[model samples]
Target chain A: MRKTVLVVEDEFLIAMDLKLLLERHGWWVLGPAASVEEALALMDEELPAVAILDVTLRDGTVSLVAEALRAEDIPFVVASAYDKPEHVGGEILAGAPNVGKPTDQRLLLAALEQAIYRMNGTSLPLDP
Target chain B: MNLEDLYRLMRNGHVQAQGIIDTVPEPLLVLDQNLCVQTASRSFFSTFKVDRDETIGQHLYELGDRQWDIPELRLLLEDVIPKSKAVVDYEVEHDFPGLGRRTMLVSAHRLFHPDNISRSLLLSIVDATKRREHEAEKDVLLGELRHRMRNLLALVQAMARQTTAAGRSGEEYRDAFLGRFNALVQAHDVAFSHNGAADLQQVVERTVAPYSGSPAGVIVEPGPTVPLASGQIMSLSLILHELATNAIKYGALSVATGQVRLRWEIEEASAPRLRLVWQESGGPPVAAPASSGFGTQLIEFAAKRELGGRVELNYAPAGLMVEIVAPLASVS
Candidate 1:
């Protein structure tokens, strides 16, 4: 199955930018969700191989959503301008990966793949 | 008395007759029919700081050694003072003692002491330096007030921005943002107090102090002291403001146990550059943001364009860490 990535973002331009970047990198981009409710709904309907979460969404922290994905065994990476982790809670992401804001395409892709491998122990095809 | 009698008595110095002219505070002088400065009042000698005895025998031209004198004084007293029928005053550069040279108002009144033949002129002079000095001081004060007002306005604008941004976050976020904004404006005021030459260490220390007190338990320690240019100082201050705001709402400072380590050092490799590291730990696992916001955009803009620097923001398991590198020459 083709690997899918979920992109949750509020800004229209940022969402489009990420979507295009992911597509150019050959990963199937699921969505550029603008709000927490929308991202949560999408998470229920679709199961992405890697979820890229922006800590501060339009309405809520993606931390809860990341927790839900953790329960479901779906891996996600957090990205924010905030200099601290666990924005939603102080739950040290045991093996989770984080990406900083305005991140370069290569760095973001690395974080995504790393989170994916950590969640499933290399179940998906590895892209070195 | 008749014209002849008036002249005889005036020249002879009758005590009551000379009292009126000599008692006047105005520096009054008497010119004989030839306009020769003759037998002037005591005021004439004292007011001009003249050797009273030396000038007693001289003509108008030979009065007190005038610094800025007009040879036309006799003409003015003879022609203008009589025809005008009123006190006639004109500006002259007076040569006076103790006061080297000055602008003065010389007024002359043509009078005949109860007799037409005895022609005498009463001349008075007043100094005008104090007025000019007062006006100059007023202009300087106005300029200083204008500068202070502009700085105050900038501070108010920053406060407004902080409030609106914090309003988007929770109470904890609001307090943190407010605290940071206050620090920025306060630092600006202090810097401007010394005309924008504030010590760089004082500015940075205040900038990072608030973050150390956040709910996230972040610890901010200032690095080695270095001087920064005024513009660079302001840019760095804003950068810290934006970073602190973000950390309070969504980063390490937001959590109760998150910790942040801030340190800066001067690198003396090929070029002298300053490197700063912001490390966050004891917080939740880190990840890339789903979307970049204004805070993210500002970081890049200030670091790159304003400060001419490079920044790397990494989302790590321990938390989010940031690295900033800028040239040392940018200090203004």
Candidate 2:
């Protein structure tokens, strides 16, 4: 089975581009949700192997989804234009790579691959 | 660069730097480690007009006693140089070389190597002729601001005393001038707190803080600290206090029957801002004043000029409303 990825973003253009890039790489794409609450609901039904979270969502913070991911044993990466990774906590930054705002398509895929491998308890190509 | 080599080059460079001194505009002099004059710029030479051939190896104290050649300067330079700290300092004097009797701001610095060691002393002199004149102008302007505002207060007091001189009770002049005077005093006080700059909120709080009793039913709450320039603070404080005083006198807190409400906001969120509003309700209907006076002129035009805002007066059935939408600013 192909690896599954969730892209949670508020901006329509950035989310569209991310979804298109992941699909081209032969991965299954889940909902490109715009809000933290929407992403949480989507995950309740289908647990994607990895998720890309924008730190700031329309109504609230993506930390809620991060908490859920921790409980469910799923890995997630944070991509944001405004917030620094340190603000979320050092440990969160340790588990995830900070793919800063305006990320390249190739770099986003690389982060997703590393996240998936780490979640499955396989040896990381490089320790996160 | 290697530290010792850099120091050797710098020490030799100052010894060779005499050729460059003549071209500098300011009076510059290079002093050796022993505090002996090693080089003097052309400006410095023409300024003091001492015989150059005779003065090169001569001690600086060999020059006659005057404003330019003082022992205090040598002591100051010697004291700060050993610490390897660079200093740009000021000194005011009645007269100087070529620049005749005027205030001069002297700056001294010790030349140091990249290794953080003192090499030689470099002293630069600037003619502070224009700067003194500018400072004088500022002093005059601040003096005028104080005088005009004080006169305005006295004028309000005179008007009050004259208006109620007839058969009215003590409450009449108290009604006419007390609120306006309270506003004026509060505005001045607020200016001091803001370091002579004030905004709408500063003025409001200063005026209302005194009589702001829970039983009196007028609660004054100040929002975030916004800095107002000295001039604006004065006018804005007076206006807000005047308004509050009136509300307490006859409009809101005067009668045992009602209370007053005052609050302000920054309406235009984009560029320079505007004062949102000061809405006073739950009071008796505000009747138009029988005559427009200085208070009206200040609220309508003077305060507008001070704050650069447009004033809106609403005589609603419930209470009086004065909303000023002006270019927003904390400090000038």
Candidate 3:
């Protein structure tokens, strides 16, 4: 079964590109929604297997959606321009994996896999 | 010496000390152990804009309309200096009666006399307001630069990702991506040259300059001087680049005699608006494409989405004409 990944990003072009990239990796992509309200509304309809969140939205910080995702025990990663945890919020950034903005595709995928592996309690394969 | 002679010598020493304090350049004040001003320098009265009569006999806190009454400064002078005998470069920002807010660096030392057992404090005030303001402004500019650099990187990343999808082969992808990236860099260079402002006439000429094969190939019309903001400059640069690229490859710039006329004017609407035109003439015939390509989409998207403008392209039989209309407030 293909697991669904939710992408919460405000930038229109980048969001569309991320959706296409994630779909190419054989994962079902959910809403590349632009805001907290939209993300929560999508989540209400169906729970995704994983979520990729941008720290800042068009209106404000996405800590509210992050908190809700955490409450649901969903695995997620923060893709942000800021490096410091306090740049978003210390408490929210503490547990989630963070990949800085303008990150390479490989890094994004590896982070996604790491999140999924943690959620599934499966060990990553060792390279010989 | 007898008691009378000793009293005369002490009075003379006090007068000389007061003269020396008044001559010092930095604002200086001598305060007794009780924190009452014993004397003040001429610099102090001028700096704080207060008279000697109001300062000398008054408590240090109450002097110059209670301007010297800063809580941290009081703690440093009375409590810290009493224990340590001196405090150096203690900063206090305060607003005096005539002077607005100013940052003052206070350095105080405990002065003790050989004959007299009483202790007095010599306080020096150095104004650091200008230096502090310059440093703060520098910090803000540095932060803004860092932020812009990161955003540019993110934009490049997305551009690279999209360009890859435009082609099947790595070589093709590399070519397309470099073309787009160089266009973006050119826009940045123009923005930098103007220091976050660009003139409308200059923008059009510069963007179309490369496509002009001869001196008369591209004609730029005179228009009212309008300054564009940095963001608007970047978007307009990209739009002009796409249009010029198309012209060079398929429109006016392809032929030796083909011509492109660029002009703009300020339209007085409900709110003032900028109306620009890119009209190509003497080009080998023109026809609308079956579907909009990336370049067309890019121009339309930039004009509509980024600049909050309207873009119209007329693929007439004679030549291609593009008109972009945007609110002046939105562009600038």
| Per-prediction TM-score to the true structure, in the order listed | 0.50, 0.38, 0.63
| lDDT by residue (tens digit), candidate 2, B1-332 | 89999999978886667667777888777776666676778887676666566556656656434444655566566675566556565564555555577655557667766775657778776667788789899977885676445444434533343333356687876765566665555666667765666655656666667656746555555555556766666567656655666677667666766666665655556756656456666777788788764456556643454565678877777877777777766335
- Give the candidate order by descending lDDT: 3, 1, 2
Off by over 4 Å in 2: A1-128, B1-171, B174-179, B214-216, B221-225, B285-294, B329-332
Highest TM-score: give the candidate number.
3
DockQ for every prediction shown: 0.01, 0.00, 0.28
Candidates arranged by TM-score, highest first = 3, 1, 2
After superposing candidate 1 on the true structure, give the runs of residues whose Cα lies further than 4 Å from its correct spot: A1-128, B1-134, B151-181, B193-195, B214-216, B285-298
Give the Cα lDDT of each candidate: 0.67, 0.65, 0.81
RMSD of 3: 6.5
Candidate 2 clash pair list: B22-B42, B196-B230, B197-B229, B198-B228, B227-B330, B273-B328
Per-residue lDDT of candidate 1, residues B1-332 (tens digit):
79999898777776664687687776666667565665567766676677777776567765556432464554566567768744655766654667766666677766676745687665666665555567788866774566345434434433344343423567755675566467656656657777776655666666777666656554556577777756566667766767776766677777788777777888987878888788877767778889775457556655765566788999887788889898877654
DockQ class, candidate 1: incorrect
Candidates 1 and 2 compared by DockQ, better number: 1
